[model samples]
Target: MFRRLEEGDPAVRTLWSQLVEISLQEMFGIFDRLGGVTLDYPKDGEAFYQPYLGEVIAEAKEQGVARQSDGALIIEVPGEETPLLLLKSNGTTTYATRDLAQVRYRAQTFHPAKILYCVANEQALHFRQYHAAARRLGFVPDSLELVHVKFGLMRGAEGKLSTRRGTSIFLQDVMDEAVRRAREVVEAKNPELSDREKTEIAEVVGIGALKYFDLSHDRRHDIVFDWDRMLSLKGDSAPYLQYSYVRAVQILAKVGTVNFPLDKWKGESGRFGVGLPEDVQRLVRELARFPLVLERAAADYTPHTIAQYLNDLAGQFSQFYECYPVLKAEGEDRAIRLAIVAGVANVLRRGLDLLGIKVLERM
Candidate 1:
């Protein structure tokens, strides 16, 4: 639901609006996700919060985003207001309070053992407060964990995502740009490819590259957006992975065989009998590492690790492609090399999927 809101879906807007008189603090509860800007609390005493009703109000007033003096917390999160609701007289209830209520409800209703909040790094303190409040409210206590899986903001070439000037770039726009850039590269590289082929390929390569770039960096560190870096055809980019996959498919197509004794090859005594190309063995080892890579990335809520893993796998497969001749080889050796390439292709496809990028069957 929060993701839907972030995406600006009208349905999510309607759903959030249907809530009872909501407070400034309650927005977080209904938001389901946090990011970018946040409310600020006082530095010292309660009097500082007194003027704002509570610390939540003080933060909103300081930020000049909202204030609530009526309704439940009086802000009514769903409705429209000039300058928005920043504070209310309740002194105890606010957006944060509402967030606690929602959290409590979720904890009791769903009884999820754990909750992962995907939010921006800038809102670390806000999320921390949310979790702390949940604990204080005896919502989930210590058993049901609440995690703020935060990531840095996405900036355009200009620096920082702007909302006031109507300069904030939507995620959809970013995705579209990536696809457009990728399509250009594809046309430039292969003039013979049809428009449909180029378009489909571009969608995968372009989106994959951008997603990889975003995931390649540590989530805590801010990323400076670069069109060249995110859309490059060469180096460690999405096209590179796509190219590797294309090459693998081409090799298999040319070889004209998919039959491999995969089960037997692993356990057969002949496994050690044949000298598999060093490069093939290395590629196979890399392919086998995908599950571990994905597991770690998902556990940490860091997609960059997955991107890095995909990049490394692609590089290894490319090297294997260059060093060995799958079509030229024969017997168990050929079978083994083809198997390695097949494994690489599968892992690459799956890894890209996890990053929310498409995988093209051909370049």
Candidate 2:
């Protein structure tokens, strides 16, 4: 395929163009479903860099960074054992060569301070080699940050999924199943809800559950995908967070903002904090950490940090809920409880949004 493309076969070009267009459409469709993902950033595929492949190979050879080894062009990056292949024996460009071209193109065009590859952990070696080669070839300056944001895979009961072996589970299928299961929960828990409400809420809960399960884990460790675990309402899942958020919404709604005046208690968190308002300490403390959590998560590139913080915040709210009686309490006490609920609802909604999970007013 690469050889035919490099040779400029008319038939191959037509088919390749059609395939790339279709594949991109399909890929963007999946990204839409995943949420919190966007392709607005400048990007170019292998086809865009194909024309420069030979130029890159020639330059590599001229710079003495690449050599013909076993009838192929390879770059043996210093301190790395596995050499990066620039061309196959057929003189067709490799993925590494295309990537190197992209590096050069972006470096000259955008002058970006950093280039990050959010690829699977298995490609660690490839990034190391290509990045080293890019630097050696002077494609990028030494100060330009080339980062590999590696994350673990989702394993099934059989073990790690493999697309080559046809053992990979379709993400759409998993999503559909989660939504179906979420619908069932909605029906059982709130049968009186409208049909439209049920469907919308299920989608929010189901997709949220899946996202939460993945993001809640430490990015470096692998996670086992289980329907029960992913959708659990009482556990550290998206549904649990969503449910807690909705529960707070429900409490606020039941009291009716007019009756309790949530606005009156606003900004009174300091007055109602810790020992001042009694048992509200945990929730107040967690709520206070929201800003710091955002800063830390951004600095570390760890979404799970937000996930874990939301999880703990939800748990603290759960404890506060059991200990305090929002609806039963009167006057100052009731307003304080409602204020805490309001604070939790806000943070949970915002934090979940940060993770690309949708929120529901009630579910």
Which candidate should be chosen as best, given TM-score against the real structure? 2
All candidates: TM-score: 0.70, 0.91
Instruction: Report clash pairs, candidate 2.
Output: none
Output the TM-score of candidate 2.
0.91
User: lDDT tens string, model 1, 1-363?
Assistant: 654643447987677655522543455442222122344533322222223234444443455334444542322332223222222353334445445545665677778888887788887766666665456435585888788888888776778878997888766577778888888888888889988888877776776776678877889888888889777656577777777777777777776756534444343442421345555555655665677887898788888888888888887776777878777889866777887777777777777777666666577
Candidate 2's displacement at residue 65, Å, is 1.5
Q: Could you give candidate 2's per-residue lDDT for residues 124-229 as a string of tens digits? A: 9999999989999999998799999889999988789889878888878888989999999999999999999999999888988888888888887788888898
- Cα lDDT for residue 335, candidate 1: 79
Cα misplacement distance, residue 360 of candidate 2 (Å): 0.8
Could you tell me the TM-score of candidate 1? 0.70
Error of 1 at 25 (Å): 26
